[model samples]
Target: MSTDTQHGESSLLIQLQHGLKREQFERALHDIRAGWNRRELWMTLGLHDVRQRYRRSKLGPFWITLSMAIMVLALGLLYGQIFGQDLHDYLPFLAAGFVIWGLIASLVNDGCQSFILAEGMIRQLNAPLSIYAYRGLWSILIAFAHNIWVFLGVALWFGVDLNWNLLWVPVALLVLLLNGLWMALFLGLVSARFRDVPLIVGSVVQVLFFITPVIWKPEMLPGRALWLDLNPFYHLVEIMRAPLLGQAPALANWLPVIAITVVGWAVALFFYSAYRWRVAYWV
Candidate 1:
């Protein structure tokens, strides 16, 4: 072919690539909207997952509450003595932070399997892939509901003050859930293609729990520390934990949480739009 003919073909290919990308982006948005519109379906599936996990058990889902309560009590006693902190203050803080961390961690860990574990459904069903993400998030939220009571009990035991700021807990949870949605979709997509991603994520989350001030306090740091500010998990926990402890989250915390949410969704949607259709095949 002549130089001009080859150049024209290249230009045509570029145009087609852009058009394909635009089409994929539109379908991605539709999948997200359609999945949300079918909330009732995912919600039921999520609830069934929770029940199925505890079927034939005496305590059912309340086992989550019992297990969390035991963990909070054990950690509170051990760490309170180790850190020389008063139980009254420390337990409530630990409980609030730990429960919030549970939700965040579970959202991430289970989010990896959001598509992988739904392999059968992905292959056999024609539902939007986002529904699997939603189902995983809802299951995590159900567990969070069970675990929140542990924090409430700790608050009551410690005589933690309740104030108008407590109202922010719901708003904080709503924001966290928004973040979780993207996390599930993004991580689920990646994990579907790379089986090892979930293992890596699980290990990372375990390490983060130790360093993110769940069983400890940020104030324990002797001086102004940069790592605490840089730790997104710290900000995430603080956003919810502060409200539960009857305080407004610092502007510092809100800024990072909001920034992460916006950036996370943008990245998640870009990849999800580009590769969502491949999830079925990847799984």
Candidate 2:
């Protein structure tokens, strides 16, 4: 607390801030790298979010599992009849698609609120902005883990053939998780600045659920298979759902998905680097 010591500490703080201000890209990189280095902190925050959400409920996160199971069964039965597919074959496909879609849709929708939801922490703490994004995505991963149990149960009940192709599922899920990271960073920044972004995201996700082939199959659209080719969400779902249902995804699916991943990250990084410093103010 001596005068010279206090002066030195103040000078150090100014130097650090000035260094960060020197280059926006470097500042953004530092934030992302620092957030990764502080995995323990973000992981703890992610777990805390899950706990807070299920605090007083007896079933806790299983409630999500139950709800997902009900949706799959109800849709599988209704849509199976509509699409003229056997229930046994249709249920497994529907279950896997719905489970994967739930994760993808939730990540995109929730990414919109990642920063805004953590407004108080951003204002009062010195953590990197990307830390909130990481935490939000981690929470989504945890929820996905819970919801996937429904798929397992459906698979068991239907006796779907298991093949070595199932091994690719983890890789596909990892790719989706990578997409989730950039999405959280990009959408979080935009949503913090524009309050309407989350609402728009929600509406889009709702519409996509019907059109993205979750309840129906591509075979249902035989003449215009191009529709599935153009839908990025379909590509995402196909990469995992096809493998889970014991079929290999086409090369076409992987090509567009990888391209989108690269382009999406490029766009996310540019805006995140440029506007990251403004997040606290916006939120």
Give the winner by lDDT.
1
- Model 2 C-alpha RMSD to native: 7.1
**Candidate 1's C-alpha lDDT?**
0.91
Q: Write the per-residue lDDT of candidate 2 for residues 34-107, one digit (tens) a residue.
A: 98988899899898899898989999888889999999888888888887899889999999998999899978
Name model 1 segments beyond 4 Å from true. Answer: 1-20
What's model 2's TM-score? Answer: 0.90
What would the per-residue lDDT of candidate 1 be over residues 1-283, giving only the tens digit for each residue?
6355556646534543653588899999999999999999999999999999999999999999999999999988999999999999999999998899999999889989999999999999999999999999999999999999999998987899978999889999999999999999999998998899999999999999988988888889889689989999999999988888888779999999999999999999988877787788789
TM-score of each: 0.93, 0.90
* Steric clash pairs (candidate 2): none
Which stretch of 10 consecutive residues in model 1 shows the poorest summed lDDT?
A: 11-20
Evaluated against the true structure, the overall lDDT of model 2 is 0.87
Clashes of each: 0, 0
Give Cα distance to truth, residue 120, candidate 1, Å.
0.5
All candidates: CA RMSD in angstroms?
5.1, 7.1
